[model samples]
Target chain A: MGTVTGKVLPQPTRDEIRVETVLQALADPVRLRMVAELANSAEPIPCGHFDVEVGKSTVTHHVRTLREAGVIEVRQVGTARASTLRKDDLDARFPGLLTGVLSGVD
Target chain B: MGTVTGKVLPQPTRDEIRVETVLQALADPVRLRMVAELANSAEPIPCGHFDVEVGKSTVTHHVRTLREAGVIEVRQVGTARASTLRKDDLDARFPGLLTGVLSGVD
Candidate 1:
């Protein structure tokens, strides 16, 4: 059971992180809010910190989508998982793209 | 019926446009290809010129999504509807963002 749950986790490759995926991941309002919050944070945020009103299953789905799209990175620390925006990856993939959009989010 | 049909067509306000909507619209593979083709074109392309294998209804839906998200603009010309990338709007909204990612598509 433990191994099965572990196998279900996402492990996205660099090649899979296409611009379309990144865009799609950011398209949802809920996901965008989460991304905005993460962008504004100085440290990695626990997944639970996001106040999205979706069901737990949907929240997991959104997080997985973002993670697979390379918009964010997740790491397990103790019993909690921390997510951080992959600002550097996005910058390298499309220079000034993320920063520019983020500025307009306000 | 004419009024209803016209009203069904989207007329998105500037404020209605959001980054997440744009990102979501481009996330689909077919839409991304369409955007790439539009980006490569110097002028507007007829909606039917896109060879996407999806059903006509689905294609229309995709186009509507792009149009509503402010990624593309549509105009009626004779019997056909033409679509063009809203490059200038995107530029104003997020400077150098589209051009940068487009360069990496190849």
Candidate 2:
């Protein structure tokens, strides 16, 4: 929720999150890499830090897709948008999912 | 791998399996329901047993998608096709994924 700009981005509550949407968000290569990077980090990252092949609008679309699916949290941080994996919510909804998906990479 | 019929279907080896593809396959409502039913079952189920809104060809397509993603195994049994979730391979590749995804239901 951004008060100054008055732009309220929709976010699903932890209990409202569903596995189907989360799986769809993680199915994409670019989105999954973004999640992998965010998952490994201790801090939330600005969306600009994500390396993707798509153009500006496409990137925004992908991020929105993930955000809407409740796989990640995104909020405006000054001029930049900060994003982080909703690990706790996901783990709570579907236990061991975070570890399961992350373990495939390392 | 099946023999006698000579109808060869493609499948990813356990080591070659990727999370993105598996997630993509599981993202579908029909496919995921099919998987959930199969995952819970101790025995392989005939594809005909699945109740879906799609036509026969469409169901075939969905099953093929899941099979190629290496999330499930499908083999020819007489004239019908038998499908089973590849729980062992998936669990080994992405530790706890089976439990993670399945636990969402119950």
Candidate 3:
């Protein structure tokens, strides 16, 4: 468990990030789109800023999945949670994976 | 469905391959290992030749999943089934995805 801006958001560490788990998280369409958006962004994106059309709970579920999979990090930013793709850590663990998946996103 | 040495094997075309589905197929450890082995091999490998320690039925299940997801193409080679990674088609569709995943495989 880690805290960001006083809120706790549990996520896997660099070594805990498994390739199978990362792939499983990205296997969902909505989550993949959210990751893609985060990948293209220059800064942490508020959860509401994602382009997914799902309900609030669904969005929360997807975000949690991504964070737990170590594909992204979520932190409390002001009144909302912001997410950023864990590109550096992921690249270090699985070189070329994030870039390839992001580029392959349709 | 297409014929391979007189046996029918079904697979998705280049345009039919989806990133999410491909990721889902590769999400399992067993299936991912099979794919990595295929990536390292220069020729089609017999199904029984894979290094997985699973049962025959389980291996068949995993192989079917990969074949259905368009990750590998299984064909009849003599009395046994031989599998090959669909590298060219996957590369054409998803660019560096297969390479990245295979390289990242532990």
Q: What would the TM-score be for candidate 1 when compared with the true structure?
A: 0.79
Clash pairs, model 2 backbone = none
Instruction: Please provide the root mean square deviation of candidate 3 (C-alpha atoms, Å).
Output: 4.3
**Model 2, span B1-106: residue lDDT tens:** 3223424357899998988888888888888888888877777777778867778888888889999999888878678787878889998999988788887753
Candidate 3 or 2, higher lDDT: 3
Highest-lDDT candidate: 3
- For candidate 3, the docking band is medium
Worst 10-residue lDDT window, candidate 2 chain A: A1-10
Residue by residue across A1-106, what tens digits does model 2's lDDT show? 3332323368999888888888888888888888889888877777677777777777788889999989888867688788878888888888998899989864
Candidate 2 at A21: error in angstroms?
Answer: 0.7
Candidates 1 and 3 compared by TM-score, better number: 3
Segments in model 2 whose C-alpha atoms lie over 4 Å from true places: A1-8, B1-9
Q: What is the C-alpha RMSD of each candidate to the true structure, in Å?
A: 7.0, 4.1, 4.3
Task: Give the better candidate number (1 or 2) by lDDT.
Answer: 2
True contacts kept of each: 0.63, 0.81, 0.70
Q: Tell me the tens digit of each residue's lDDT in model 3 across B1-106.
A: 2334646488888788888888999988888999999888887878788999999899989989999888888887678988989999988887777776776677
lDDT of 1 by residue, A1-106 (tens): 1111111236566555777667777778888888989999887776787878988778778888889888888877667677878887788787876776675575
Q: lDDT, candidate 2, residue B64?
A: 94
Query: Which of the two, 1 or 2, has more TM-score?
Result: 2
Q: Tell me how much of the true interface, by contacts, candidate 2 captures.
A: 0.81
